[model samples]
Target: MPDLFHPQMMGYLESLVPQRHEVMLEMEARAREIGFPIIGIAGGQFLYQIARMMKATRIFELGSGYGYSTAWFARAVRENGGGVVHHVVWDEKLSSQAKDYLGRLGYSDIVQFHVAEAVETLKATEERFDLIFNDIDKVGYPASIPVIKERLRPGGVLLVDNMFLHGSIFDPANTSEAVQAIRTTTKLLTQDPQFISSLIPIRDGIMLSYYVP
Candidate 1:
Protein backbone atom coordinates (compact mmCIF):
# COMPACT_ATOMS: atom_id res chain seq x y z
CA MET A 1 0.00 0.00 0.00
CA PRO A 2 2.54 2.60 1.18
CA ASP A 3 6.19 2.69 0.26
CA LEU A 4 7.11 6.28 1.09
CA PHE A 5 8.92 5.94 4.44
CA HIS A 6 9.59 3.55 7.25
CA PRO A 7 7.39 3.75 10.33
CA GLN A 8 10.16 5.27 12.48
CA MET A 9 10.82 7.94 9.87
CA MET A 10 7.15 8.81 9.76
CA GLY A 11 7.02 9.06 13.52
CA TYR A 12 9.83 11.58 13.34
CA LEU A 13 7.92 13.55 10.77
CA GLU A 14 4.84 13.45 12.97
CA SER A 15 6.76 15.13 15.79
CA LEU A 16 7.45 18.16 13.59
CA VAL A 17 3.80 18.84 12.94
CA PRO A 18 1.63 20.63 15.48
CA GLN A 19 0.29 18.41 18.25
CA ARG A 20 -3.17 16.97 17.87
CA HIS A 21 -6.28 18.06 19.76
CA GLU A 22 -6.18 17.31 23.47
CA VAL A 23 -8.64 14.47 23.07
CA MET A 24 -6.58 12.91 20.32
CA LEU A 25 -3.44 13.53 22.32
CA GLU A 26 -4.92 11.47 25.10
CA MET A 27 -5.97 8.83 22.62
CA GLU A 28 -2.46 8.74 21.23
CA ALA A 29 -1.10 8.18 24.70
CA ARG A 30 -3.59 5.45 25.37
CA ALA A 31 -2.90 3.82 22.04
CA ARG A 32 0.77 3.67 22.83
CA GLU A 33 0.29 2.57 26.41
CA ILE A 34 -2.11 -0.21 25.47
CA GLY A 35 -0.39 -1.24 22.24
CA PHE A 36 -3.25 -0.26 19.97
CA PRO A 37 -1.87 -0.40 16.44
CA ILE A 38 -4.96 1.26 15.02
CA ILE A 39 -3.96 4.66 16.28
CA GLY A 40 -2.19 6.62 13.55
CA ILE A 41 -1.36 10.21 14.50
CA ALA A 42 0.65 11.07 11.40
CA GLY A 43 -1.95 9.43 9.22
CA GLY A 44 -4.59 11.50 10.94
CA GLN A 45 -2.58 14.66 10.33
CA PHE A 46 -2.38 13.80 6.65
CA LEU A 47 -6.15 13.48 6.56
CA TYR A 48 -6.48 16.63 8.62
CA GLN A 49 -4.40 18.63 6.19
CA ILE A 50 -6.48 17.37 3.29
CA ALA A 51 -9.66 18.36 5.05
CA ARG A 52 -8.25 21.75 5.90
CA MET A 53 -7.08 22.27 2.35
CA MET A 54 -10.48 21.35 0.96
CA LYS A 55 -12.32 23.50 3.47
CA ALA A 56 -14.46 20.46 4.26
CA THR A 57 -17.86 21.26 5.67
CA ARG A 58 -19.85 18.13 6.44
CA ILE A 59 -17.74 15.06 7.24
CA PHE A 60 -18.37 11.44 8.14
CA GLU A 61 -16.18 8.76 9.64
CA LEU A 62 -16.63 5.01 9.61
CA GLY A 63 -15.21 3.28 12.67
CA SER A 64 -13.96 6.30 14.60
CA GLY A 65 -11.85 4.81 17.34
CA TYR A 66 -12.04 6.99 20.44
CA GLY A 67 -12.45 9.99 18.15
CA TYR A 68 -8.81 10.37 17.23
CA SER A 69 -9.26 11.04 13.51
CA THR A 70 -12.77 12.31 14.05
CA ALA A 71 -11.39 15.12 16.20
CA TRP A 72 -9.06 16.17 13.42
CA PHE A 73 -11.90 16.14 10.90
CA ALA A 74 -14.05 18.11 13.31
CA ARG A 75 -11.35 20.70 13.85
CA ALA A 76 -10.85 21.09 10.13
CA VAL A 77 -14.53 21.73 9.51
CA ARG A 78 -15.13 23.62 12.76
CA GLU A 79 -12.47 26.23 12.04
CA ASN A 80 -14.58 27.11 9.02
CA GLY A 81 -17.38 28.35 11.33
CA GLY A 82 -18.91 25.24 12.85
CA GLY A 83 -19.43 22.53 10.29
CA VAL A 84 -20.83 19.16 11.32
CA VAL A 85 -19.21 15.74 11.38
CA HIS A 86 -21.12 12.52 11.95
CA HIS A 87 -18.78 10.06 13.66
CA VAL A 88 -19.77 6.38 13.63
CA VAL A 89 -17.96 4.59 16.41
CA TRP A 90 -18.93 0.94 16.82
CA ASP A 91 -17.63 0.23 20.26
CA GLU A 92 -19.85 1.43 23.07
CA LYS A 93 -17.12 1.93 25.64
CA LEU A 94 -14.89 3.64 23.15
CA SER A 95 -17.74 5.76 21.83
CA SER A 96 -18.54 6.99 25.33
CA GLN A 97 -14.91 7.80 25.91
CA ALA A 98 -14.69 9.73 22.62
CA LYS A 99 -17.83 11.73 23.39
CA ASP A 100 -16.39 12.90 26.70
CA TYR A 101 -13.20 14.03 25.02
CA LEU A 102 -14.94 15.78 22.15
CA GLY A 103 -17.28 17.49 24.62
CA ARG A 104 -14.32 18.80 26.58
CA LEU A 105 -13.03 20.38 23.39
CA GLY A 106 -16.47 21.96 22.75
CA TYR A 107 -16.90 19.85 19.65
CA SER A 108 -19.90 18.17 21.20
CA ASP A 109 -22.28 20.42 19.27
CA ILE A 110 -20.79 19.37 15.94
CA VAL A 111 -20.10 15.65 16.37
CA GLN A 112 -22.87 13.08 16.16
CA PHE A 113 -21.55 9.89 17.71
CA HIS A 114 -23.17 6.67 16.56
CA VAL A 115 -22.67 3.48 18.53
CA ALA A 116 -23.60 1.10 15.75
CA GLU A 117 -22.06 -0.70 12.84
CA ALA A 118 -20.77 2.03 10.53
CA VAL A 119 -22.26 0.43 7.45
CA GLU A 120 -25.62 0.30 9.13
CA THR A 121 -25.33 3.91 10.16
CA LEU A 122 -24.32 4.95 6.70
CA LYS A 123 -27.28 3.09 5.26
CA ALA A 124 -29.65 4.76 7.67
CA THR A 125 -28.40 8.31 7.36
CA GLU A 126 -29.63 10.76 4.77
CA GLU A 127 -26.89 13.36 5.06
CA ARG A 128 -24.16 13.90 2.45
CA PHE A 129 -20.58 14.78 3.32
CA ASP A 130 -17.57 16.70 2.02
CA LEU A 131 -15.06 14.24 3.52
CA ILE A 132 -15.18 10.61 4.64
CA PHE A 133 -12.79 8.40 6.60
CA ASN A 134 -12.87 4.60 6.42
CA ASP A 135 -11.22 2.59 9.20
CA ILE A 136 -13.26 -0.42 10.04
CA ASP A 137 -12.79 -4.19 10.02
CA LYS A 138 -10.56 -4.42 6.97
CA VAL A 139 -12.64 -7.16 5.42
CA GLY A 140 -15.50 -4.73 5.15
CA TYR A 141 -13.61 -2.07 3.23
CA PRO A 142 -14.19 -3.17 -0.34
CA ALA A 143 -17.91 -3.51 0.17
CA SER A 144 -18.13 -0.05 1.65
CA ILE A 145 -16.22 1.78 -1.06
CA PRO A 146 -19.25 2.27 -3.29
CA VAL A 147 -21.30 3.42 -0.33
CA ILE A 148 -18.60 5.89 0.68
CA LYS A 149 -18.11 7.22 -2.83
CA GLU A 150 -21.82 7.78 -3.28
CA ARG A 151 -22.15 9.97 -0.22
CA LEU A 152 -19.25 12.21 -1.04
CA ARG A 153 -19.88 15.50 -2.81
CA PRO A 154 -18.08 16.11 -6.08
CA GLY A 155 -14.39 16.62 -5.37
CA GLY A 156 -14.89 14.98 -1.99
CA VAL A 157 -12.29 12.67 -0.48
CA LEU A 158 -12.35 9.22 1.13
CA LEU A 159 -9.32 8.40 3.26
CA VAL A 160 -8.57 4.82 4.28
CA ASP A 161 -6.20 4.23 7.19
CA ASN A 162 -4.11 1.12 7.90
CA MET A 163 -3.92 0.21 4.27
CA PHE A 164 -0.95 -2.10 4.72
CA LEU A 165 -2.06 -4.02 7.81
CA HIS A 166 1.44 -4.27 9.31
CA GLY A 167 2.79 -5.93 6.15
CA SER A 168 0.61 -8.94 6.78
CA ILE A 169 -0.85 -8.79 3.31
CA PHE A 170 2.51 -9.61 1.82
CA ASP A 171 3.65 -11.91 4.59
CA PRO A 172 3.50 -15.52 3.45
CA ALA A 173 2.44 -16.86 6.82
CA ASN A 174 -0.51 -14.52 7.05
CA THR A 175 -3.90 -15.40 5.66
CA SER A 176 -6.20 -13.02 7.39
CA GLU A 177 -9.43 -11.30 6.48
CA ALA A 178 -7.84 -7.91 6.95
CA VAL A 179 -5.13 -8.78 4.49
CA GLN A 180 -7.64 -9.96 1.94
CA ALA A 181 -9.65 -6.79 2.34
CA ILE A 182 -6.56 -4.69 1.85
CA ARG A 183 -5.68 -6.54 -1.33
CA THR A 184 -9.17 -6.45 -2.73
CA THR A 185 -9.72 -2.79 -1.89
CA THR A 186 -6.36 -1.78 -3.25
CA LYS A 187 -6.94 -3.60 -6.50
CA LEU A 188 -10.42 -2.14 -6.83
CA LEU A 189 -9.22 1.38 -6.10
CA THR A 190 -6.27 1.30 -8.48
CA GLN A 191 -8.53 0.26 -11.32
CA ASP A 192 -11.47 2.51 -10.56
CA PRO A 193 -12.13 4.99 -13.34
CA GLN A 194 -13.72 7.65 -11.14
CA PHE A 195 -10.96 7.93 -8.55
CA ILE A 196 -7.42 9.20 -8.76
CA SER A 197 -5.71 7.43 -5.86
CA SER A 198 -2.43 7.16 -4.05
CA LEU A 199 -1.14 5.22 -1.06
CA ILE A 200 1.08 7.06 1.42
CA PRO A 201 3.04 4.89 3.80
CA ILE A 202 3.64 6.65 7.06
CA ARG A 203 3.04 4.48 10.13
CA ASP A 204 0.99 1.82 8.34
CA GLY A 205 -0.05 3.39 5.03
CA ILE A 206 -3.13 5.37 4.08
CA MET A 207 -5.10 5.30 0.84
CA LEU A 208 -6.26 8.72 -0.28
CA SER A 209 -8.87 8.67 -3.04
CA TYR A 210 -10.85 11.53 -4.50
CA TYR A 211 -14.05 11.81 -6.51
CA VAL A 212 -13.34 14.07 -9.47
CA PRO A 213 -16.95 14.36 -10.56
Candidate 2:
Protein backbone atom coordinates (compact mmCIF):
# COMPACT_ATOMS: atom_id res chain seq x y z
CA MET A 1 0.00 0.00 0.00
CA PRO A 2 3.02 2.19 0.13
CA ASP A 3 4.11 4.29 -2.81
CA LEU A 4 6.59 2.08 -4.65
CA PHE A 5 7.03 4.64 -7.39
CA HIS A 6 6.83 8.41 -7.46
CA PRO A 7 3.63 10.11 -8.65
CA GLN A 8 5.45 11.55 -11.65
CA MET A 9 6.68 8.10 -12.67
CA MET A 10 3.22 6.64 -12.27
CA GLY A 11 1.80 9.35 -14.50
CA TYR A 12 4.55 8.66 -17.02
CA LEU A 13 3.66 4.98 -16.99
CA GLU A 14 -0.03 5.66 -17.58
CA SER A 15 0.75 7.87 -20.56
CA LEU A 16 2.55 5.16 -22.54
CA VAL A 17 -0.57 3.39 -23.84
CA PRO A 18 -4.18 4.43 -24.34
CA GLN A 19 -6.00 1.74 -26.33
CA ARG A 20 -8.57 -0.28 -24.37
CA HIS A 21 -12.22 -1.33 -24.67
CA GLU A 22 -14.95 1.18 -23.85
CA VAL A 23 -16.20 -1.10 -21.09
CA MET A 24 -12.68 -1.76 -19.82
CA LEU A 25 -12.08 1.95 -19.75
CA GLU A 26 -15.33 2.59 -17.91
CA MET A 27 -14.66 -0.15 -15.39
CA GLU A 28 -11.17 1.23 -14.83
CA ALA A 29 -12.64 4.67 -14.30
CA ARG A 30 -15.05 3.25 -11.76
CA ALA A 31 -12.24 1.49 -9.92
CA ARG A 32 -10.28 4.70 -9.89
CA GLU A 33 -13.27 6.74 -8.80
CA ILE A 34 -13.95 4.30 -5.99
CA GLY A 35 -10.27 4.34 -4.92
CA PHE A 36 -9.84 0.63 -5.73
CA PRO A 37 -6.61 -0.69 -7.20
CA ILE A 38 -8.33 -3.30 -9.41
CA ILE A 39 -5.16 -3.93 -11.43
CA GLY A 40 -3.84 -0.57 -12.58
CA ILE A 41 -3.39 -0.08 -16.31
CA ALA A 42 0.35 -0.16 -15.81
CA GLY A 43 0.03 -3.46 -14.00
CA GLY A 44 -2.17 -4.94 -16.72
CA GLN A 45 0.26 -3.80 -19.37
CA PHE A 46 3.10 -5.39 -17.49
CA LEU A 47 1.20 -8.65 -17.18
CA TYR A 48 0.53 -8.66 -20.90
CA GLN A 49 4.22 -8.22 -21.55
CA ILE A 50 5.02 -11.12 -19.26
CA ALA A 51 2.53 -13.37 -21.02
CA ARG A 52 3.97 -12.38 -24.36
CA MET A 53 7.51 -13.03 -23.25
CA MET A 54 6.47 -16.47 -22.09
CA LYS A 55 4.64 -17.11 -25.38
CA ALA A 56 1.61 -18.19 -23.44
CA THR A 57 -0.74 -20.38 -25.46
CA ARG A 58 -3.29 -20.92 -22.71
CA ILE A 59 -3.93 -19.04 -19.51
CA PHE A 60 -5.94 -19.43 -16.32
CA GLU A 61 -6.89 -16.78 -13.82
CA LEU A 62 -8.12 -17.02 -10.27
CA GLY A 63 -10.26 -14.14 -9.01
CA SER A 64 -10.65 -12.11 -12.18
CA GLY A 65 -12.62 -8.93 -11.46
CA TYR A 66 -14.36 -6.93 -14.19
CA GLY A 67 -12.22 -8.60 -16.91
CA TYR A 68 -9.69 -5.80 -17.30
CA SER A 69 -6.73 -8.08 -16.65
CA THR A 70 -8.51 -10.93 -18.40
CA ALA A 71 -8.74 -8.84 -21.56
CA TRP A 72 -5.05 -8.16 -21.43
CA PHE A 73 -4.23 -11.82 -21.07
CA ALA A 74 -6.71 -12.65 -23.80
CA ARG A 75 -5.01 -10.26 -26.21
CA ALA A 76 -1.65 -11.77 -25.41
CA VAL A 77 -2.93 -15.31 -25.93
CA ARG A 78 -4.81 -14.41 -29.11
CA GLU A 79 -1.61 -14.04 -31.10
CA ASN A 80 -1.27 -17.81 -30.96
CA GLY A 81 -4.30 -18.13 -33.28
CA GLY A 82 -6.58 -18.51 -30.27
CA GLY A 83 -6.44 -19.54 -26.62
CA VAL A 84 -8.68 -20.24 -23.71
CA VAL A 85 -8.86 -18.27 -20.48
CA HIS A 86 -10.71 -19.64 -17.51
CA HIS A 87 -11.70 -17.05 -14.90
CA VAL A 88 -12.84 -18.44 -11.58
CA VAL A 89 -14.71 -15.84 -9.63
CA TRP A 90 -16.35 -16.68 -6.32
CA ASP A 91 -19.02 -13.99 -6.37
CA GLU A 92 -21.93 -14.32 -8.77
CA LYS A 93 -22.41 -10.58 -9.07
CA LEU A 94 -18.74 -9.91 -9.79
CA SER A 95 -18.57 -12.87 -12.13
CA SER A 96 -21.62 -11.67 -14.04
CA GLN A 97 -20.19 -8.20 -14.20
CA ALA A 98 -16.94 -9.59 -15.55
CA LYS A 99 -18.80 -11.70 -18.11
CA ASP A 100 -20.81 -8.72 -19.33
CA TYR A 101 -17.72 -6.57 -19.34
CA LEU A 102 -15.76 -9.14 -21.35
CA GLY A 103 -18.68 -9.54 -23.73
CA ARG A 104 -18.52 -5.84 -24.40
CA LEU A 105 -14.81 -6.20 -25.08
CA GLY A 106 -15.54 -8.82 -27.79
CA TYR A 107 -13.65 -11.43 -25.82
CA SER A 108 -16.47 -13.63 -24.63
CA ASP A 109 -15.38 -16.37 -27.02
CA ILE A 110 -11.85 -16.55 -25.72
CA VAL A 111 -12.88 -16.16 -22.09
CA GLN A 112 -14.99 -18.48 -19.94
CA PHE A 113 -16.56 -17.65 -16.62
CA HIS A 114 -16.95 -20.01 -13.66
CA VAL A 115 -18.70 -18.62 -10.65
CA ALA A 116 -17.18 -20.91 -8.07
CA GLU A 117 -14.31 -21.32 -5.68
CA ALA A 118 -10.94 -21.55 -7.45
CA VAL A 119 -9.62 -24.70 -5.82
CA GLU A 120 -12.82 -26.65 -6.27
CA THR A 121 -13.20 -25.55 -9.87
CA LEU A 122 -9.64 -26.54 -10.66
CA LYS A 123 -10.37 -30.04 -9.49
CA ALA A 124 -13.08 -30.52 -12.14
CA THR A 125 -11.23 -28.97 -15.08
CA GLU A 126 -8.72 -31.15 -16.96
CA GLU A 127 -7.29 -28.16 -18.79
CA ARG A 128 -3.60 -27.41 -18.42
CA PHE A 129 -2.34 -23.90 -18.79
CA ASP A 130 0.72 -22.34 -20.39
CA LEU A 131 0.36 -19.50 -17.93
CA ILE A 132 -1.53 -19.06 -14.66
CA PHE A 133 -2.37 -15.92 -12.73
CA ASN A 134 -3.58 -15.97 -9.17
CA ASP A 135 -5.26 -13.09 -7.37
CA ILE A 136 -7.70 -15.17 -5.44
CA ASP A 137 -8.82 -14.89 -1.83
CA LYS A 138 -5.69 -14.07 0.06
CA VAL A 139 -6.65 -16.25 2.98
CA GLY A 140 -6.78 -19.28 0.69
CA TYR A 141 -3.58 -18.60 -1.24
CA PRO A 142 -1.46 -21.03 0.73
CA ALA A 143 -4.03 -23.78 0.33
CA SER A 144 -4.18 -23.07 -3.40
CA ILE A 145 -0.43 -23.45 -3.80
CA PRO A 146 -0.56 -27.22 -4.17
CA VAL A 147 -3.53 -26.93 -6.44
CA ILE A 148 -1.79 -24.32 -8.59
CA LYS A 149 1.38 -26.35 -8.74
CA GLU A 150 -0.61 -29.37 -9.78
CA ARG A 151 -2.31 -27.47 -12.58
CA LEU A 152 0.69 -25.76 -14.11
CA ARG A 153 2.01 -27.56 -17.19
CA PRO A 154 5.67 -28.38 -17.39
CA GLY A 155 7.70 -25.29 -18.28
CA GLY A 156 4.64 -23.18 -17.66
CA VAL A 157 4.70 -19.94 -15.67
CA LEU A 158 2.78 -19.02 -12.55
CA LEU A 159 2.22 -15.39 -11.77
CA VAL A 160 0.86 -14.46 -8.36
CA ASP A 161 -0.42 -10.98 -7.55
CA ASN A 162 -0.38 -9.20 -4.19
CA MET A 163 2.65 -11.08 -2.92
CA PHE A 164 3.52 -8.37 -0.42
CA LEU A 165 -0.03 -7.76 0.69
CA HIS A 166 0.94 -4.13 1.12
CA GLY A 167 4.27 -5.22 2.65
CA SER A 168 2.74 -7.45 5.30
CA ILE A 169 4.55 -10.66 4.22
CA PHE A 170 7.72 -9.47 5.88
CA ASP A 171 6.18 -8.93 9.28
CA PRO A 172 6.27 -12.03 11.45
CA ALA A 173 3.50 -10.62 13.58
CA ASN A 174 1.18 -9.96 10.66
CA THR A 175 -1.82 -12.17 11.36
CA SER A 176 -3.77 -11.85 8.13
CA GLU A 177 -4.46 -15.20 6.50
CA ALA A 178 -3.61 -13.83 3.09
CA VAL A 179 -0.27 -12.51 4.23
CA GLN A 180 0.60 -15.83 5.74
CA ALA A 181 -0.46 -17.54 2.55
CA ILE A 182 1.78 -15.29 0.51
CA ARG A 183 4.64 -16.03 2.83
CA THR A 184 4.09 -19.74 2.61
CA THR A 185 3.90 -19.71 -1.18
CA THR A 186 6.94 -17.50 -1.45
CA LYS A 187 8.87 -19.91 0.69
CA LEU A 188 7.88 -22.82 -1.55
CA LEU A 189 8.94 -21.03 -4.72
CA THR A 190 12.14 -19.83 -3.15
CA GLN A 191 13.30 -23.27 -2.06
CA ASP A 192 11.88 -25.38 -4.83
CA PRO A 193 14.67 -26.81 -6.95
CA GLN A 194 12.62 -27.12 -10.08
CA PHE A 195 11.52 -23.53 -10.27
CA ILE A 196 13.00 -20.07 -10.56
CA SER A 197 11.08 -17.36 -8.74
CA SER A 198 11.37 -13.62 -8.52
CA LEU A 199 9.44 -11.07 -6.50
CA ILE A 200 8.69 -8.39 -9.05
CA PRO A 201 8.28 -4.93 -7.56
CA ILE A 202 5.35 -3.94 -9.67
CA ARG A 203 2.16 -2.65 -8.07
CA ASP A 204 1.71 -4.35 -4.69
CA GLY A 205 4.43 -6.78 -5.82
CA ILE A 206 3.88 -9.74 -8.15
CA MET A 207 5.61 -13.11 -7.98
CA LEU A 208 6.69 -14.68 -11.25
CA SER A 209 7.66 -18.36 -11.21
CA TYR A 210 9.07 -20.43 -14.03
CA TYR A 211 8.99 -24.21 -13.91
CA VAL A 212 12.17 -25.95 -15.00
CA PRO A 213 11.88 -29.06 -17.10
Candidate 3:
Protein backbone atom coordinates (compact mmCIF):
# COMPACT_ATOMS: atom_id res chain seq x y z
CA MET A 1 0.00 0.00 0.00
CA PRO A 2 1.05 3.56 -0.66
CA ASP A 3 2.00 5.73 2.27
CA LEU A 4 -1.22 6.37 4.16
CA PHE A 5 0.55 8.96 6.23
CA HIS A 6 3.87 10.63 5.41
CA PRO A 7 6.79 8.66 6.84
CA GLN A 8 7.85 11.48 9.15
CA MET A 9 4.30 11.99 10.39
CA MET A 10 3.83 8.31 11.05
CA GLY A 11 7.12 8.12 12.89
CA TYR A 12 6.21 11.18 14.96
CA LEU A 13 2.86 9.71 15.91
CA GLU A 14 4.41 6.37 16.83
CA SER A 15 7.09 8.06 18.87
CA LEU A 16 4.45 9.82 20.93
CA VAL A 17 2.95 6.56 22.18
CA PRO A 18 4.13 5.59 25.64
CA GLN A 19 6.25 2.52 26.09
CA ARG A 20 4.45 -0.85 26.07
CA HIS A 21 5.11 -4.11 27.86
CA GLU A 22 8.00 -6.25 26.69
CA VAL A 23 5.59 -8.92 25.46
CA MET A 24 3.65 -6.42 23.41
CA LEU A 25 6.89 -5.13 21.97
CA GLU A 26 7.87 -8.67 21.08
CA MET A 27 4.51 -9.11 19.36
CA GLU A 28 5.22 -6.01 17.29
CA ALA A 29 8.61 -7.33 16.34
CA ARG A 30 7.12 -10.67 15.31
CA ALA A 31 4.55 -9.00 13.08
CA ARG A 32 7.28 -7.03 11.35
CA GLU A 33 9.48 -10.10 10.94
CA ILE A 34 6.78 -12.19 9.30
CA GLY A 35 5.16 -9.30 7.41
CA PHE A 36 2.03 -10.16 9.37
CA PRO A 37 -0.52 -7.44 9.91
CA ILE A 38 -1.39 -6.30 13.39
CA ILE A 39 -3.09 -3.05 14.29
CA GLY A 40 0.31 -1.43 15.10
CA ILE A 41 0.96 1.01 17.90
CA ALA A 42 -1.42 3.78 16.86
CA GLY A 43 -4.39 1.56 16.17
CA GLY A 44 -3.83 -0.64 19.21
CA GLN A 45 -3.47 2.41 21.44
CA PHE A 46 -6.62 3.86 19.91
CA LEU A 47 -8.49 0.70 20.80
CA TYR A 48 -7.11 0.84 24.32
CA GLN A 49 -8.18 4.44 24.78
CA ILE A 50 -11.64 3.84 23.37
CA ALA A 51 -12.25 0.83 25.58
CA ARG A 52 -11.08 2.70 28.63
CA MET A 53 -13.09 5.82 27.76
CA MET A 54 -16.28 3.86 27.25
CA LYS A 55 -15.62 1.69 30.29
CA ALA A 56 -16.36 -1.25 28.07
CA THR A 57 -16.31 -4.59 29.87
CA ARG A 58 -17.48 -7.08 27.31
CA ILE A 59 -15.56 -6.88 24.04
CA PHE A 60 -15.66 -9.25 21.08
CA GLU A 61 -12.97 -9.23 18.42
CA LEU A 62 -13.72 -10.85 15.07
CA GLY A 63 -10.22 -11.27 13.73
CA SER A 64 -7.81 -11.24 16.63
CA GLY A 65 -4.31 -12.24 15.52
CA TYR A 66 -2.01 -13.69 18.14
CA GLY A 67 -3.67 -11.42 20.70
CA TYR A 68 -1.82 -8.16 19.96
CA SER A 69 -5.04 -6.15 19.84
CA THR A 70 -6.62 -8.49 22.35
CA ALA A 71 -3.91 -7.61 24.86
CA TRP A 72 -4.77 -3.93 24.54
CA PHE A 73 -8.46 -4.58 25.14
CA ALA A 74 -7.64 -6.93 27.97
CA ARG A 75 -5.58 -4.27 29.68
CA ALA A 76 -8.42 -1.79 29.38
CA VAL A 77 -10.87 -4.30 30.71
CA ARG A 78 -8.59 -5.00 33.65
CA GLU A 79 -8.43 -1.33 34.51
CA ASN A 80 -12.16 -0.98 33.93
CA GLY A 81 -12.77 -3.20 36.95
CA GLY A 82 -12.42 -6.45 35.02
CA GLY A 83 -14.42 -8.11 32.24
CA VAL A 84 -14.07 -10.41 29.28
CA VAL A 85 -12.65 -9.94 25.80
CA HIS A 86 -13.51 -12.59 23.24
CA HIS A 87 -10.71 -13.34 20.78
CA VAL A 88 -12.08 -15.08 17.72
CA VAL A 89 -9.91 -16.17 14.81
CA TRP A 90 -10.16 -19.09 12.40
CA ASP A 91 -6.59 -20.30 12.71
CA GLU A 92 -5.86 -22.80 15.43
CA LYS A 93 -2.14 -21.99 15.47
CA LEU A 94 -2.85 -18.30 15.82
CA SER A 95 -5.25 -19.00 18.65
CA SER A 96 -2.63 -21.12 20.38
CA GLN A 97 -0.03 -18.42 19.98
CA ALA A 98 -2.45 -15.87 21.36
CA LYS A 99 -3.19 -18.07 24.32
CA ASP A 100 0.48 -18.27 25.15
CA TYR A 101 1.16 -14.58 24.57
CA LEU A 102 -1.85 -13.39 26.53
CA GLY A 103 -1.06 -15.82 29.30
CA ARG A 104 2.42 -14.37 29.51
CA LEU A 105 0.89 -10.89 29.48
CA GLY A 106 -1.33 -11.95 32.44
CA TYR A 107 -4.51 -11.53 30.41
CA SER A 108 -5.47 -15.21 30.40
CA ASP A 109 -8.14 -14.44 32.93
CA ILE A 110 -9.62 -11.65 30.82
CA VAL A 111 -9.72 -13.20 27.34
CA GLN A 112 -11.59 -16.09 25.77
CA PHE A 113 -10.25 -17.63 22.57
CA HIS A 114 -12.24 -19.21 19.77
CA VAL A 115 -10.97 -21.02 16.71
CA ALA A 116 -13.97 -20.84 14.41
CA GLU A 117 -15.46 -18.68 11.74
CA ALA A 118 -15.67 -15.32 13.47
CA VAL A 119 -19.05 -14.10 12.27
CA GLU A 120 -20.69 -17.45 12.82
CA THR A 121 -19.23 -17.62 16.31
CA LEU A 122 -20.57 -14.17 17.06
CA LYS A 123 -23.99 -15.10 15.79
CA ALA A 124 -24.02 -18.21 17.95
CA THR A 125 -22.86 -16.38 21.02
CA GLU A 126 -25.79 -15.53 23.27
CA GLU A 127 -24.36 -12.72 25.30
CA ARG A 128 -24.38 -9.16 24.01
CA PHE A 129 -21.22 -7.09 24.06
CA ASP A 130 -20.33 -3.54 25.00
CA LEU A 131 -17.87 -3.32 22.09
CA ILE A 132 -17.21 -5.31 18.93
CA PHE A 133 -14.06 -5.03 16.79
CA ASN A 134 -14.18 -6.38 13.24
CA ASP A 135 -11.00 -7.09 11.29
CA ILE A 136 -12.02 -10.15 9.34
CA ASP A 137 -11.48 -10.56 5.61
CA LYS A 138 -13.01 -7.63 3.73
CA VAL A 139 -15.27 -9.88 1.71
CA GLY A 140 -17.10 -10.78 4.92
CA TYR A 141 -17.61 -7.18 6.01
CA PRO A 142 -21.11 -6.52 4.66
CA ALA A 143 -22.58 -9.78 5.86
CA SER A 144 -21.11 -9.38 9.33
CA ILE A 145 -22.87 -6.06 9.97
CA PRO A 146 -26.30 -7.41 10.89
CA VAL A 147 -24.76 -10.01 13.14
CA ILE A 148 -22.59 -7.39 14.80
CA LYS A 149 -25.62 -5.15 15.23
CA GLU A 150 -27.51 -7.97 16.84
CA ARG A 151 -24.71 -8.92 19.22
CA LEU A 152 -23.73 -5.41 20.25
CA ARG A 153 -25.89 -3.79 22.88
CA PRO A 154 -27.59 -0.52 22.07
CA GLY A 155 -25.14 2.29 22.60
CA GLY A 156 -22.26 -0.14 22.20
CA VAL A 157 -19.41 0.58 19.79
CA LEU A 158 -18.30 -1.25 16.63
CA LEU A 159 -14.78 -0.79 15.28
CA VAL A 160 -14.10 -2.12 11.77
CA ASP A 161 -10.55 -2.14 10.41
CA ASN A 162 -9.12 -1.96 6.90
CA MET A 163 -11.86 0.33 5.61
CA PHE A 164 -9.23 1.86 3.33
CA LEU A 165 -7.95 -1.54 2.10
CA HIS A 166 -4.43 -0.10 1.93
CA GLY A 167 -5.83 2.74 -0.24
CA SER A 168 -7.57 0.39 -2.64
CA ILE A 169 -11.07 1.52 -1.69
CA PHE A 170 -10.39 4.94 -3.22
CA ASP A 171 -9.58 3.48 -6.62
CA PRO A 172 -12.66 3.33 -8.81
CA ALA A 173 -11.04 0.83 -11.15
CA ASN A 174 -10.43 -1.62 -8.34
CA THR A 175 -13.91 -3.11 -8.37
CA SER A 176 -12.73 -6.26 -6.70
CA GLU A 177 -15.14 -8.06 -4.37
CA ALA A 178 -13.16 -7.08 -1.28
CA VAL A 179 -13.18 -3.40 -2.23
CA GLN A 180 -16.87 -3.46 -3.13
CA ALA A 181 -17.68 -5.21 0.12
CA ILE A 182 -15.87 -2.50 2.02
CA ARG A 183 -17.84 0.15 0.09
CA THR A 184 -21.09 -1.59 0.90
CA THR A 185 -20.11 -1.91 4.56
CA THR A 186 -19.25 1.76 4.67
CA LYS A 187 -22.63 2.71 3.30
CA LEU A 188 -24.32 0.35 5.73
CA LEU A 189 -22.61 1.94 8.69
CA THR A 190 -22.83 5.57 7.57
CA GLN A 191 -26.27 5.60 5.94
CA ASP A 192 -28.07 3.36 8.39
CA PRO A 193 -30.19 5.18 10.92
CA GLN A 194 -29.25 2.79 13.67
CA PHE A 195 -25.59 3.75 13.63
CA ILE A 196 -23.52 6.85 14.18
CA SER A 197 -20.29 6.28 12.24
CA SER A 198 -17.00 7.95 11.43
CA LEU A 199 -13.95 6.71 9.59
CA ILE A 200 -10.80 7.31 11.61
CA PRO A 201 -7.76 7.49 9.33
CA ILE A 202 -5.34 5.83 11.70
CA ARG A 203 -3.12 3.25 10.07
CA ASP A 204 -5.50 1.64 7.54
CA GLY A 205 -8.67 3.52 8.51
CA ILE A 206 -10.90 2.14 11.23
CA MET A 207 -14.65 2.64 11.04
CA LEU A 208 -16.02 3.56 14.42
CA SER A 209 -19.75 3.03 14.59
CA TYR A 210 -21.95 3.53 17.59
CA TYR A 211 -25.02 1.35 17.45
CA VAL A 212 -28.01 3.44 18.43
CA PRO A 213 -30.37 0.50 17.99
The candidate that wins on TM-score is 3
What lDDT does the true structure give each of the candidates? 0.82, 0.82, 0.94
Model 3, position 203, has a per-residue lDDT of: 88
lDDT of 2 by residue, 1-213 (tens): 986567587568767867877787898898989786577787898888988888887898988886778988988888767878888887888888888888877788899899988778876778778888988877777777788778889899988889878878778888776777778888988788877999887778888899876
Which lDDT value does model 2 have at 115? 90
TM-score of each: 0.91, 0.90, 0.96
Which of candidates 2 and 3 is the stronger one according to TM-score?
3
Error of 1 at 206 (Å): 0.5
Candidate 3 — what's its lDDT? 0.94
Model 2: lDDT equals: 0.82
Residue 205 lDDT (model 3): 93
Which segments of candidate 1 are over 4 A away from where they belong? 1-7
Count of clashes in candidate 2: 0
Candidate 2: list runs displaced more than 4 Å: 1-7
Among all candidates shown, the one with the greatest lDDT: 3
Model 1: per-residue Cα lDDT over 1-213, one tens digit each: 986556479669778778656666777888889987654766777777898999898988888888878778888888877788888876899989889888988789889989899977886778778888888888899999888877888888888888888778778677787788898899888789888899887677888888888
